[model samples]
Target: MLCLTAQSALQGRSDRSAWQYTRADTPGTGSVRWLAVTDHFHGEQVLRIHVVAGPDSPSPGFPLPRAGEVVASPAMQRLFASTPDDQLDDRFPGEVTGTIPVDLLSHPEQLIAVVGGEVPGMFTAAGIATSPDHAFFAFARIIVGIAALVLLVPVAVFVVMASRIAAAQRERRLAALRLVGATRSQTAAIAAVESGIAALAGTFAGWLAYEGLRRVLASSVTYEGFPFHAADVRAPLAALVLVPLLAVLVSVFPLRRNASKLPTAVRALPLAVGIGGLFLVTYTSAAGFDELAALFVISTVVGALVVGPWVCLQVGRLLARARSATTALAARRIEHDPKASFRAASALVFAAFAATYLSGLVSAYGDLPGTGIPPGVVTVFDGRDREIVSDGTMADEERIRTREAIASPNAIINTRREFVLRERRLWDDVESAVHFAVTIVVVVAGCGVAAGAAGGVLERRRSFALLRASGTTLGQLRRVVVLETGVPLVAMTGLGVALGVLTLVATKGPLPTPGFAAVVASGLAVALLVAATPLAVLERASGIDAIRPGTSA
Candidate 1:
C-alpha cells in the first residue's frame, strides 16, 4: 500500500507536469499586456485586482468564461461592471471581466519564470511551490521509492511471523497424517488448500480495508495546492495480484520447523565488524560517509538480527544459574528452543534500530537556522542582498529582483521571517514523519509479539499441561513465561537503542545528542507491552484437556 500510494502520487505529478508543459506549448492566440498588479481600494478591504492592458475584442489566449479577453478576479469584474468610468483609475486598462485558465494558476512559479515579469511580494502562493521535481524528478522518484523499501521490511517481518506461527501448527497436523500412512503429496495438497483459502480471504479483506480507508481519507483530507485526486491513489494491478500469491507461498512453505538446537554465537561477528566500521569512520578522518561507511552502518542492524537468537541462548544459560526457580525454568525453556524465544524480538529489533537512528537523525539535523544576513539565519542566495536588510526588515528593497524573478520584499522569501518559517516547518515535518514511521514499525512489532505469544502457548500446550499437572502453579508458569521472554525483549530493546545511538554518534556529530530518557522510556514502554502479550493466553494453554498423553491439540 505504501508503495502503491507513492506510485500514485508520482504518476499524478507526472500527469500534471506533462499537461502543464503541453498547454504552455499550445501557442495560445491572446494579445494582452499584463500591467502592474494594482491593489483596489474598496472601503477597508483590500481586493485583488488583476489589471491587463488589452482591447475589449476577443482576446487571443484562452478566453475567460465571461465575454472579456483577460484573466482578472471577480472583484475586478464587479468593479468594471458596476463602477462609473470616472470613479475608477483615470488610466484603467480596458474594462475586462474573465477567468484565467485554471492551468495558468496551477503553475504560477513556472509561468512567472517564463514570463520574466515582476512578482508581487504579497503572495506566497508560488513561493511554497518549491518545484521539487522540476530538475530532479528522478531524484524525487528515488526518494519516494526508498519509502517502499523501508516499509517492505515491516511487511516482511509481519509475514515471517505469520508463517512461523502457521508452520508450528502445520507440523503437528501434517506429522500426524504422515504417521497414518498419508502420502507426502496428500499432506502437501491439504496444506496448499488450507493456505490458499485463508490467503484468498485475507487478501480480499485487506483490499477492502485499504479501499475504505483511502476513500475516508480522500473525502476528509485536503491539500494546500495541486490537489492530488483520490482516483490516483490506486494500487497497481500487479500489486493486487501479488499479495495473495505471496501470502499463500508464505503460509505453505514457512521456515523449516526442525531447527537444530545449535548455539548461534558466531552471528555476533558481523555486529563486531559493523561497530568496527563505525570506529573507522568516526576516528580515521574519513571524509563524508562513503558507501563503505553506509555498509558499516547497515551492518550493525543486520548483524543484530541473527545475533538476537544467540543472545537469547546466552541469556537462558545465565538465567539457568539464577537462584529463582521461575527464572531457572524459563531459562531452560529458552535454551531448548532459542530461535523460538527470539522470534518476536526479531521484529522489535527493527523497530529499535529505526527508533534510535531516526531519533539521532532528528536531533542532529532537525534544526539549521541559517547563518546569513541577520547573522543567525542561513543566507538566501549567498546573502548578496545585505543592503536590503535594515532595522530587521526587507523594507529596503520593496522590489527584490533575482535571476528567478523580480520578486517583492513581501513575497515568500529565503530571508528573515520566511527562513524562520521554513526552519520551523522543517522541524515540524521531520518530527511528524519520524513519529508516523516509528508508530507504524512499533505496530508491526506488536503484531509479531502478539502472534508469537499465541503461537508459543499453542506449541507448548503439552508442556504447559505437564507443568500444571505437576506441583507447578499457573502463577509460577506465568512468571516463567515473563522471565524467559521478557528478558530477551528488554535486552533486544536496549541493544537496539545502544546500537542506534552509537551509530548516530558515528554518522552524525555528537553535539545535539538524542534524548536518552525519552527514547529509552518509549522503547521500554513498547517492549513491556509486547512482553506481556503472552500472559493473555496462559489460562487456556494450561487447561486439563492438554494433559492427555497422546493429544497434540
Candidate 2:
C-alpha cells in the first residue's frame, strides 16, 4: 500500500513541473504580484493559478497569507482582485499564469524529493487530494455513526433472550432439587448455581463468536490505507462476567414469583411467562416511550420461555382450521402435549434467526449499488508549467489515442476495471455494516416462532390424549403434521420470496437481476425452515399416551 502511494506521488511529479519564486508584490518588494499558472488538461481552454502575493500590501488579518505563500487560484484571484476583503470559495477552478512549474521551483530546495509519481501537495495536487481533510472525515463519521446505531437492536435482543433462558432454566433446576427433599434455601442455591454455570457457558460461546469474527475480519481483505483495531480480550471477558450478572439481576423477580407459586402454577410457569412477555413486546413496540418500551421489551423476552408450549397449541389450531380428515388428529396430539412438542420445536427460534438474517444479508448485498465509472478519459493535473504523470482513468464514450509506446493498453479498459473494483467494495461495505442487524432480526423472529410452538403444545395436550384414546397411530400423527406444516411452509415460502423481491421497492433500491434472484432464494429457504416445525413437533408428540390422564411417559 505504501509503495503504491509513493508510486502515485512520483508519477505525479514526473508530469508536473514544480517552481518556487518570491512574490514580486510583497510590501517591501517590487509592485508586481508573482502568480503561479498551469494548463488545465491537454486542451488550452483553461488555466490554473495560485496567488503568490497581494499587490504591494500585507493581508488584513493575523495569520494572513505569508510573503512567499501561495494564496488563491485563477478564479479566486479574479474574484479577490475586486473585493480585496472577500473570502475565497474553496472550489475555485485551477489556473496557471506567472511562476515556474514545480520541478523548476524545487531546484533550490532539497526538501522536495522527486518521486516517480505525483507528489501530494496543495498547489501541485488536483481534485480531492487538493480538498480539505475535514470533508472526508465528516463523511466517514456519518457512515460509522449509522453502522453503530443500527447494531444496537441486535445487542438488546441478545441481552433480553439470554436473560429469559437463564431464568427459565434456573427455575426448572430449582424445582427438581425441591422434589428431591432439598430445602427452599438449597433449591434457591441450586438455581443460582445452575444459572451461574449456564451464564459462564453462554459467555464462553459469545467470546468464541467474537474471536472468530475478529480473525475473519483480520484475515479478510485489508483496507489499503485504513486502520482497523482488533477487539480487546478484556472486553470479551468483561462481557462474560456482565452477561451472568445481568441474568442474575433479571431473574430476581421471576425467581421470587416462581417460588411463591403452587406446584400446579409451576407447571403453568412457562406459558404464563411467555404470554406476559408477548404482551410486553406488543406493548413496547406500540408505546413508543423509552421507559415503557424497555419494560415491554423485557416482557416480550420473558415470553420466549413459554414459546415452545404456545407454538404447539397454535399449530394444532392451524391444523384443525385447515379441516383435513387427519388435521384433527394432528392438532389434538400437538395441543395436549407439553414436553413432546417442546423437544421437537425447541429450535424454532434458531431457524427463524437463520431465515431472517439470511434474508437481510441477501437483500443488503443484492441492493448494493454498482460502480458507475465510465471509460476512456484521463484527468491531468498541470500545475505551474508541466503535466502530472498520474493521469486519471477515463470515462466511457471518451476516445483515447494511446501512444503505442505506452505499457498499458488504453484508458478505456482501466476505467472499466476500476469501476468493477469500486462496485464490489461498495457491496461488501454495505453488507458488513448491516450484519449485526440481520443477526438480531433473525434471532427475534426465531424466538417468536419458538414461543408460538411451545404455547401450541401446552394447549393441545388434552387433544393429544384424546387422539391416543382414539387409537391414532404415531405414524399417522407424524403424517398429519407433515400435511399441516406443508401448507403453511409453502405459503410462508411464497411470502418470503415476495417480500424479498418487494424489498427493492420498499428500500427504493434494486441491483442487477442476478443479485435480486439470489436474495429471493434465500428468503424461500428461510420460509421452508419455519414451515418444518410442525413435522418435527409431530415426531416428539407421536406417543400420545403420556398426554392421557392415566398415563406417564
Candidate 3:
C-alpha cells in the first residue's frame, strides 16, 4: 500500500547520474569509477552487466545481476510462477552479484528470487514479478482520520454553540424590529441574513487557520509516510450553515415568548433567557454527548455568568441575616432588587469560571499538584484557587528543617532527580516540579475582571444616569463603578487563590514557589479588576446622555 502511494511522490523516471570507466585501464589499480543509470520510476527489475577486461587487464569477463532482478532461464521462470507468495520466501537463494557480494534488497516489499553469478555459491533462483506494496498511503490515511477527529470538538464548541446562542439573541432583536413596523417575515429574513453573514465570516477565518496548521504539519511530516492534504472545507462550511440554522430554530420559542410580553416585562427578558439557558446547559451536561468535556466546560463558564447575580444576591442576604447593619442593608437591597444587583454581579461569575478553568488547565500542564491551599478550604471557599510560581531557588536547609519538624512520627523523605524544560532545553518529565500557579491565577482573575466590567456596565445603566444627574462628576461615577466591581473581583479572586492553595495541598501535597506566587498575584489582580469595572463604565457612559435619547449608550 505504501509503495503504491509513494509512486506518486517519486521524482519520476530518469536514470540517475552515474560515472563509469573501462575495467582494462584500472585492472591493476583495482578501482571502480562512479557510473549513472536511469531508473525513471524505479520500474526496472535489474541490469545485466558484463565487465570485460581491457588490453591492460585479465582476459576473462565478470557478470552480475541487480537486486530483486532475476537472471533465470525459461525453465526457471516457469517453475517459480507456480510458487505461492507465502511459500516463495524460504526457497530464495542469496542475492547474486559479481564475484564479490552485497545485500541488494533493503525493503521488505521488494522481495523476489535472486539469480545469476558465476561465483562458487552463486545460483540462479526462480522468481516472478508483481506490483510492490504501499505503506505510505495507509499510514497517511490513519493520520488524516485522527486529525479530523481531533478538530471536531472545536467545531462543535465554536460553530455550533455560537450559532445557538446567536439564534436565541436574534429572536428578541428581530421581534423588536417587528414592533417597530417590521413584518414578521421581515424579521425572520433579517435573522437569516445575519446568520448567513456570521457563518461566512467564521468559515473564512476557520479556513485560514486550517491552512496555516496544515502547512506547519506538512513540514514536520515526511511525504513518504503521512502526507499532508488540505482539510476539506466542505465539512466546515456545512457546520457553519447547519449550526446557525439550528441556533435560529432554538431561538424561535424564546423570541415568541418575549414578543408576547409587555414592554415592562420585555425589560426582564434577559433574566428569563438566562434562567432558561442555565437549565438547558445543566440538562445538556447531564446527558452524555460527543465532546462532553468541552461542553461541560463551556456550560459551566456560561452557567457561572448567568447565575452570578443570583449568587451575589444570596450572599448579600446571608450577610444581612447576620444582623450587621451595614451588610444587612446592602444584602436587603440586593435581594429586593434582582435586576440591579443580579446584573451587576453577573460578571463575577464569568470571572470565576474563567479563573477556575484557566487555572486548572495551566496547572495541569505540569506534574505538580495545584496551589498549596488545603482541601478543607473548599467547604468555605468553593473550589477557586491561585496560581503557582517558582522563585528559581531551592532550599536544602528548609527541606531538612521541615523533615525534622515532623518528629511526632516517622516520615520518610527521599530525593529523586527529575528533568524539566529550561529556556533553551527540551521538555522532559521530572520529579522536581515547575511552578505555574502564579500564571494560572493571574489569567483566571483577569477573566473575572472582564466579566465584572461587562456585567456592571449592563446592570447599572439607570443608576449611573441618576448619579450623573446628581452632580457626580464622570471621574466620581467611574470611581463608584470601579468600587462596585473591584470589591467582588477582589473577593472572588482572593478566595480563588486560597482555594487554589487548598487544591494544591489536597492534590500535590506541595506548593512550590512558582505556584504560590501565581496564586497570590492572580487574587490581587482580579480583586483590583473587579474593583475597577463599575468606575470605568460609569466614566465612559457618563457622556452617553449627550447622544440622541434612543441611541446606544
Candidate 4:
C-alpha cells in the first residue's frame, strides 16, 4: 500500500501541468493560449495562470487555475470552478483570490509564458527543462523507491518465516493423519482447509493492522512537504481481494517442496555471495546512486536468506569436533536442521545491513563542506579589471537586482548555501523515515526469532524427552538448547555486521564508530536474548512428559 501511494504521488506530480490547463469549447481537446505567472507574496511563492478561455477550451482532467479566483466567460465557469478559498488560504496567505481571464488582466507584461496551445506534453518538457525542479523530483522519486524497498524486504522476510512455522505444524499434523490410514488426497484437503482458514484470519488481521497504521501515518508522516491523508494511503478494491488470495497461495505452495533436501539453501548460498560481491564492486566502482542503491537492497536480501543457514552449518561443524557430549548433541541437531535456525535469525541479518547502510549514509552527509558565506556580506566585481571587492551589506532587492544584472555570473551569485540546505533537508527526512522503518524491522525480527526458537523446541520435544529419559539432566538439556540457538545466532550476527561494514567502506562512507558499535552490540544482545528466551520458558516444563513413541519420526 505504501509503495502504491508513493507511485501515485509521483504520477500526480508528473501530470501537474495537464491538471492546470484545459480547453473550453471542446472541453477535452483542441488548442488554447495560456500564461503562467510565478511571484513571491508574503514570504511564500504563488502561482497564477491566465488562460484565453472561450467556447473551445480543452479539459486537462483535473482542477485548474489552482490558486486564484476565476474571471472567465460563463462557458469556462461551467467547465471549471474557481480555486476554493480553503485551498488558497492554506497554500497562500491572505484572503481568497480568483483567476483572471487573459482579457481581464491589466498588464500582459507580467505573464511568464504565452504558450500557443493547451499542450499536455508541456508538463513533461517543462519538468525536464527546469533543473532545480527536476533534481527535487528525482530525489523524491529515489527516496520513495528506497523507502518502499526497505518496507517490503522485512515484511517479505517475516512472511517467509511465518509460513515456515505454519507449514511445519501442518506437515506434522498431516503426517499424523497419514499414519491413521488417511489417503493422500484426504490429507491434502485437510491441510488446504486448515491453511485457507488460517490465511483468511491472518489476512483480516493484517487489513485491520494496515488501517490502524494508515490512520497513524496519515496524521504523522509527510512527503515532499505534503501530508499523507487517508485517501493517499487507501489501497484499491482489487488489492483487498488479491492480497488475501496471494496470502493463501503463499501459505499453501511450500508444501510441495521436499523439506528433506537442502538444495535450496545450497543454491541460495552461491547467489547470496555472488550478489554481495557484485554490490561491493558496484559501490567501490563509483557508480551512480541509483545503481548502488539497487545493488545494496538486492545484496542485503540475498545475504539475509543465506547467511543464517551458512553460519549455522559452519558452527555445527566446528562444534561437532568438540569432545563434550552436550556439544556433540547440539551440533548434530543444528546440522540436521539448519533451516530452523536460519528462519529464526534471517530477519536480523537484513536489519543489521539496513542500519549500517543508513548510519554510513548519514555520516557521509555530515562530512560535507560547510562553506556558505555569512549573511550581510556583499561581494562585487569590476568588469575586465577582474578585481573583486567585499564591503557593505546588501538588501534583498539589491541582491536580486544584482543577480539579474550579471551577464555571466560565476562567483558572487553562486553561493552553495541554499543547495546545501536543501540537500540536508532531503537527507534528514530520508534518515528519519529509514530510522522508523529499521525500528519496525528490528522489532518484527525479534518476534520472529523468539517464535522460531519456541517452535524449534516444540518440534524437538520428543528428542529432548529421550535425552532426559537417558539420564541427561534437565540443566544439561537446557544447555544443549542454548548452545543450539546461541552459536548460530552469534555467528550470523557477526557476519551481518561484517557485511554491513563492508558496504559502508565500499561506498566511501565513514564508519560511524559509535553508531556502528551500538548497532552490533544491540543486534547481538537482542538476537542471543531472543534465541535463548524459549529455553528459559521450557525450563519450567518437564521434557519427559512431552515424549511419545510415535512422535519421534
Candidate 5:
C-alpha cells in the first residue's frame, strides 16, 4: 500500500509544470490559505491544477487573470499578509522588482499582484508549482517509503508471534490424530482443511476492510496540498488473489513428518555472531560495507527476536527449581513451550527497537539548515548563479532554465522563505508518518498480546483449577500468569531498546539524543499496556469444571 501511494504521487508529479509564481502566506491559519487556493481552482476562475477524469469536465478552463485584470476576493486576499517590518527587504512581497527565475518571483503577472499588495489566493496550473506545495508530492513519496520500512518490523514480529500461537494449537490436535492411526498424508490434508478455512475467511474480511481503508486515506491524506484520488490507493490485484495462498503456506509448511530441528541454543550461535559482527564493524571503519552492515542489522533484529524465546526457556527452568509451588507452576509452564510463552511480547519488542533506532536517526538529522529564517522573509538570488548553494544552503531548483531566470545574473545570500516553508512541511509530513507507523505497530502488537494472553488462559484452565482445588489462592494464580508473560515482556523489550541504541550509536556515531530518548520512552510506555490485555479474561478461565480430571476441555 505504501509503495503504491508513493508511485501514485510520482505519477501525478510527472504532469506538473514548473512553478511560475510564489507568495508568502499570512501569519496564521495556513489550512485556510491552502483551502482558499483549492476553492479558487474549483470555481474555474483558474485552470484545473489536477486533471480529473470525466468526458464532461472542462479542459484548459479559464486562465487566471494578471494583476491588472484580477478582481480580488476579499476572503482570499486576507490569506496574504505583507512582509513583517522587522525582516522586510527589497524582494519582500509586493515590493520585489524585475523578475528572477527562482521561486516567488518567477511569474511576472502573479509577482505584480503580490507586489501590488491586493493578492488573490489564486494560482494558474503552472503557478501552483511556485509555492512550497510543489515539493509535497516528493515529500509524500519519501514519507510513505520510510513508513513501509519502519512498518516491516511490526509485520515481521506479528508473523512470528502468530505462527507460534498457531503451532502450539495445532500440535496437540495433530498429536492425537497420530495416536489414532492417521497417515501422514491424511494429517497433512486435515491440517490444510483447518488452515484453509481460516485463510479464506481472513482474506475475505481483509478485502472488505481495505475498501474502507482506501476511502479514509483518500479523504484525509493530502499530497501537494490536495488529496489523492480514491482509485489510486488500491492494492494490486495479484496481491489480493495471493493472500490466502500465502496464508495457507505459512500454516501448512510447518507440519512436516519426522521434522528434527537443532536446539535453540545451537541455532542462536550464528545469529549472535552476526550481531557481534555488527558491533565489530561499528567500532572499525568498515563504512564502505554498508550493505554488509545492513545484513548485520537484520541479524541483530532476528537475534533479538530469538532471544525472547530463549529467555523464556531459561527463566522457566530457573523458576521450576524454586521452592514455592506458584513459582514452580509458572516456570514449568513456560519451560514446556518457550516460544508460546514469549509470543505476546514480540510486537512490543519490535516497537522498542524501531522507536529507539528511528528516533535517534531523526534527532541526529535535526531540522533543515535554513529552517530558522523568519516567516515572511525570502532571500533573493540570480537564477544562473552556480554558487547559489555555495554557503551550505539547499537550492530550490538548480535545473531551472526559465526566461526570467536567464535574464537575472545576481545572487543574494540570505535564506529563501520558500525552501524554509517546504522543509517545514516536509518535517510535518514526516511527523505524521511516524505517528501513523507507531500506531500500526502498537495496534498489531496489542492484538497479538491480547490473543496470546487469552489463548494462554484457555490452555491453562485445567492446571489453574487443579491448583485452586489444592488450596492455591486466586491471587497466587494471577501472579503466576503475570510473572510468566509480564517479566519476559519487560526483559525482552529492554533487550530491544539496548539493541536499538547500540545500532543507532554504531551506525550514526552518536548516542540516542535526549529528544529521541523521550520519544522512545513514551512509545515503550504505550506498548507495555498491551501486556495487560490478558487480565480481562482471567475470571472465566479458572472455572471449577476444569479441575475434574479425565474429562477433556
Candidate 6:
C-alpha cells in the first residue's frame, strides 16, 4: 500500500494555474513560463522541469525563491525528489528559459495529484494508473504478495506444531474433566479458549511489529526514485479486526481432525484427472488461452495436496524392503502414518514448487530484446501552436524550425534505445525482488522443518529409548531418524519439481535447470540437518528412563 500510494502521488493530475505561461519570451507582468522535458537517465524515466523567469515575474511566496524549485513542499522535495543540479541544459534560441517564480508552483495539498502530462497507452484510476511509474508500483506489489504467501506456509506449520507440542498434557486434562462430568461440548469449548488465548497473544505481538516496520518504511526510500509518506502507511480497519479473528479460528479448527482416518485414494484420483484435463486443454487450445493457464496452476496445487502422501507411502514401502535395520525402521514409521509426515512437510513442498515455477516464468520473459518503431513511420506531437519532432523522416531544417517555434520543446530520435532501457529496468527490479523474497521464505521453512523434527523425536522418546537399550547403537538410531525425514522430504521435493516443470512446459516457458537444481539441493540439505539434530543430542545422553510408560523424558 505504501508503494502504491507513492506511485499514485507521482502520477496524479495537477491543478490549473492562472499564472501559467506557454511562451518562453512572454514580457507580460506577473507571468512565468516553464519547460518540462522527459528523458531516460541512469536506467530510469526522469522529468526535468526548467523555469523561465521574466523581468516582471510575480513574487514567489516563499524564502529562497530560486533555490531549487520543489514539488508539493520543501520538506517533500527533500524526501522524494533528487537534489537539484543547475548544470542540465536550459538553452532555447531567442527565448528566456531558466527559473520560474515559486508562486506558480503547487501547494502541498494539490501536489499529491500532479503528474505533468498524459502517458501513452495507459489507463487511469483514483489512486491507481497504468503507466511506467505505475508499472514499478505494480511489480512491487506482486513481490510483496509472493513473500507474504510464502511466509504463511511456515507460520501455518508452526501453529500446528505448537499446538501438538503439549498434546499429551491437553488430552490428560480433558480426560480428567470428562471424568468429573464435563460434557464433550464443554471440553471442546475449553480447548478452543486455551488455543485462542495463545493465538491472540501472538497476533498482538505481530501487530506491534507491523507498526514499527511501517514507521521505518514511511521515512525511507526503497527504490531509487520512490519515497513513502506517512499517509501511505495506513492499515485498514477491517484488516486489523480480521487478523486476530483468523488466528483464533486456525488455532481451534485443527484440533477437531481425526488423525486415524486416512485420506482415500479416490479422493486424490479426481484431482490428478483434473490436472491432466487442464494440461490437455492448454496444449490443444489456440493462443491466448489465459483462463486455461490459470486453471492449470490451481489444479496443480490442489493435486499436490491430495497426491503427495500417497507417493510418500509408496517410497517408504520400497525402502522397507531394504536389508538395513535402520532403513526398515524409518520406512515402517512413514508407511504407518504417512499423512502426519506429509502434513508436517507440506509447506516446504509448496514453497519449492512456487520458487521453481516463478524461476521458469522469469527466465521465459526476462531476456527478450525490446521491439522498436518500424521504419518509414514518422511520429509527431502537436505542440498546440507548432509541431514537436518525436520520431522519423523530418529533415534537419524542419526539426530546427519546429524547435524554434515551440516554447517548451521535446523530441524522441532513438525509440529503440528507450524501449530497451525501460524493459531491462523492469526485469532487473523484478528479479532482485524475487531473490530477496525467496531468501526469506527458505529461512522460515528451514526453521519450521527443524522445529517439527525436534517435536517428532520428543513424541517418540519411548520408542527411541527402547531401541537404544537393545542392541542398536546410537549411530544406527541416528541414521534411522535421518532416513525417516530425508526419504519423505526427497520424495515430496521430486514431486514438486515435476509439477513445476510440467507447468513451464505447458505454458511454453523455458526450463530453469540451474534454479530447479538449486532448490532441490537446498531443500534436501535442510531436511537432513533438521533430522540429524535430535539424534545428535540423544547420542550424548546416557539414560533409558524415557522408555518407562506414562513418563516423559
Best model number under TM-score: 1
**Which stretches of model 5 miss by more than 4 angstroms?**
1-232, 237-308, 311-328, 342-351, 365-372, 375-379, 383-417, 508-541, 547-553
lDDT (10s digit) by residue, model 6, range 276-313: 76667656766655556566667777877778777777
Answer with 3 or 4, whichever has the higher lDDT: 4
Q: For each candidate, what is the lDDT?
A: 0.56, 0.38, 0.36, 0.53, 0.51, 0.53
Q: Which candidate ranks first by lDDT, i.e. highest? A: 1
Per-model TM-score, in order, reads 0.70, 0.43, 0.35, 0.64, 0.60, 0.65
lDDT of 1 at 290: 57
What range of 10 consecutive residues in model 6 has the weakest lDDT sum?
122-131
Write model 4 residue lDDT over 1-553, tens digit each, in one string: 5434565545443444333332232233344445443322111223444444334444333223322333332322332235342322222222223333432211211121222223221221111111123465677768677766665555555555555553566787788899989998787667557657766787688778777877676556655333443444555455556545655556556543445644245645644554566555655555554555665556556756565676677778899999999899889988887766666666656666667677677767765543343433222332432322323222342344234222322222323333555466556555556556655555556556665556566666666777778888988877787787777666655666666777666556676547556656665666566656677656534455667555532
Runs in model 1 deviating more than 4 A are 2-4, 17-135, 166-169, 175-183, 215-232, 237-239, 254-256, 286-295, 365-386, 390-416, 508-534
Q: Pairs clashing in candidate 6?
A: 12-115, 13-113, 51-98, 51-99
Q: After superposition, how far is residue 504 of candidate 5 from its true place, in Å?
A: 2.5
Could you arrange the candidates by lDDT from highest to lowest? 1, 6, 4, 5, 2, 3
The list of candidate 6 runs beyond 4 A from truth reads 1-37, 49-87, 91-147, 177-297, 365-414, 513-516, 519-543
Residue 516 of model 4 has an lDDT of 51
Candidate 5 TM-score over all chains jointly: 0.60
The predicted structure with the larger lDDT, 1 or 2, is 1
**Candidate 2: tens digits of C-alpha lDDT, residues 1-553:** 1111222222222222222222332223222223322221112112223333333533212111433333332333444355322112211222212222223311111121111111122131111111122354456546544433333333444444444532444566667778889998776565566657777787678677765665444334233211122321113144457667765555544532221211122433543443344444444454644345455334433443344454445555676776666777556655555334443333333233223334455454454334443333443322322222223443112222222102221111122334445455655655543343333343333333333443344335455556756887666655665544343333333333343333323223443244434443454356346534544554454455546564322
Off by over 4 Å in 3: 1-176, 180-189, 195-311, 314-463, 483-497, 500-508, 511-513, 516-540, 544-553
Clashes of each: 10, 74, 52, 16, 2, 4
